[model samples]
Target: MSDATKLLAEKRTEFGKGAARKIRRAGNIPAVMYGHGTAPVHISLPGHDTFQALKHTNALLTIVIDGDEQLALAKDVQRDPIKPVIEHVDLVVVRKGEKVTVDVSVHLEGEAAPETLVTLDHNTLQLEALATNIPDNVVVSVEGLQAGTQILAGAVQLPEGSTLVTDPEALVVNVTQAISEEALEAELAEAEAEAGIEHEVAGEEAGEAAAGEAAAEGEPAEGASESSES
Candidate 1:
């Protein structure tokens, strides 16, 4: 566990959307801190500092509010849909030595056997570790894995002091033989046949347009003959 990042926060005296907007205008983000049977604390944090601190998954923060410090973890964060600005945040207070359950990223390293495709069934793993010692991610090696091989959750090696909270039998990674080009083309053709009504309609419409153009072209010659006779 790395040391918790320190952040300075100010207690929010006003509530409502207007106050929050004011805080944002002042280059701060509104946030709420709760957990451990304590009353929820509403505060404002520095926008740049808060954004940088949250870049790490399961980031532990030491927030200084009113000269008092509390350790916390970022539980939820709200952001602008179009902008990269943090709108709001929810923090959960945590204590040293306490075990917290969180989902850690699973990273794949190395390649499987040639002509095999490696599929990650689970991208994250639920784990229980000390609040201050959570790992950023777990790396799983697929080197030389053969087709039909599966790596289960229990088979993954976790960082020391971390325990798996997800089901042990859950499939994490699967290695399978890659489909040949011929097989892929065949499957695509089959799918097209299954949904061929639209294509057929389009083809028929094109054919009718061609036939109509031919008929229109032939009608001019017929009209010329009828006019000469008249």
Candidate 2:
């Protein structure tokens, strides 16, 4: 968790897409803070500073508005789909020691046993932790796990004071035998067959089978004619 970063904010009066565009043009992100049964506050935050501070998940921020500071957590951040800019932010007022549920990322470390493929069933786990003590991520060690090994959510060790909100029986990782290229292709072929998809090889084979089936009927084969012409 990163230390709270302070940012000076300005209250936004004008509302609409046009106003939001103007705010972004001035290098500020339009944001709304709501929580604790209080009225929502519409404000504008410094674009660069806000983006930097929000790099951490569940980022804690000290939002200073009109010389008054409020503690907030970056609950949701909207961004341009194609750009690296934050379009808007949703802040939830949080007090110290308050518990909040969030989805924390799962990071895998160490390698599994040889000739085994490690599949991460869950990339993140739902966790309930203190607002000010939210962990950045949960780490899982695969180490020397062998094939057919499975790791469940309950088996994962979470950070201190963090409670897992995800179902304990949920599968987190599965280790399986590594497949050869030929085996993978065969599996794909079987799946495509089930889906009624045909391979180009089947069509090509019917069209070019020895290119000479007509010869048995006393007619020049297409391949023979083409070869002769060539």
Candidate 3:
């Protein structure tokens, strides 16, 4: 884990949407901290500082409330759908040596073999590590990997003192034969046929066909041109 960022919080005495809105308008966000069999503490965090600190889900935070400090992790954050606003946050307390399960991102480093598509079967791996020593991400190399190659969770190396919480048999990365556009379309068509799906002509193609039919109908009858010339 990266160094914990300190955020000052104030104990909250008011509740409900109105109070929460009032808190936001005052440049703060409401949050609750609970863990280790302790009663939940409701407080408000500084808006800007908390936002910056909680950029990553696995961030470690040092919450200071009324001259007391507690280590925590943001378990959940609620944000407004249409606005850049954080409505609420749920924080879980942690001790220095406490182990916590967190999902760490899997980063691919190299290219797979030619004519192969590399797929990330699982983007993140679940790991149990000390609260203050969690890794930001796990890197896996696919250099020169050929089609049909798969990397399982058990095969991945973990940071020292970290334990894998994910199932060992979980597929992490897979390499498969790449499909060409023509092959992809053909496969889609075959699947659609098997499903009894009928596709209508595209708008542009339908318009062109209609225009050609109209022109054919407007053509003069056989020998009409000859009769007129005579």
What C-alpha lDDT values do all the predictions have?
0.93, 0.91, 0.92
Per-model clash counts, in order, read 0, 0, 2
RMSD, every candidate, angstroms: 5.7, 4.4, 4.3
What's each prediction's TM-score?
A: 0.83, 0.81, 0.82
- Top candidate on lDDT is 1
Q: Candidate 1: where is the Cα deviation over 4 Å?
A: 190-230
Error of 1 at 210 (Å): 17
lDDT of 2 at 131: 85
Decide which is better by TM-score, 2 or 3: 3
| Worst lDDT 10-window in candidate 3 | 220-229
Ranking by TM-score: 1, 3, 2
- Candidate 3: C-alpha RMSD after superposition: 4.3
User: Which has the greatest TM-score?
Assistant: 1
Residue pairs in candidate 2 whose N, alpha carbon or C atoms collide under 3 angstroms: none
- Which is superior by lDDT, 1 or 2? 1
Global Cα lDDT for candidate 1? 0.93
Local error of candidate 2 at residue 69 (angstroms) = 1.6
Locate the minimum summed-lDDT window of 10 residues in model 1: 219-228
- As for candidate 1, its clashing pairs are none
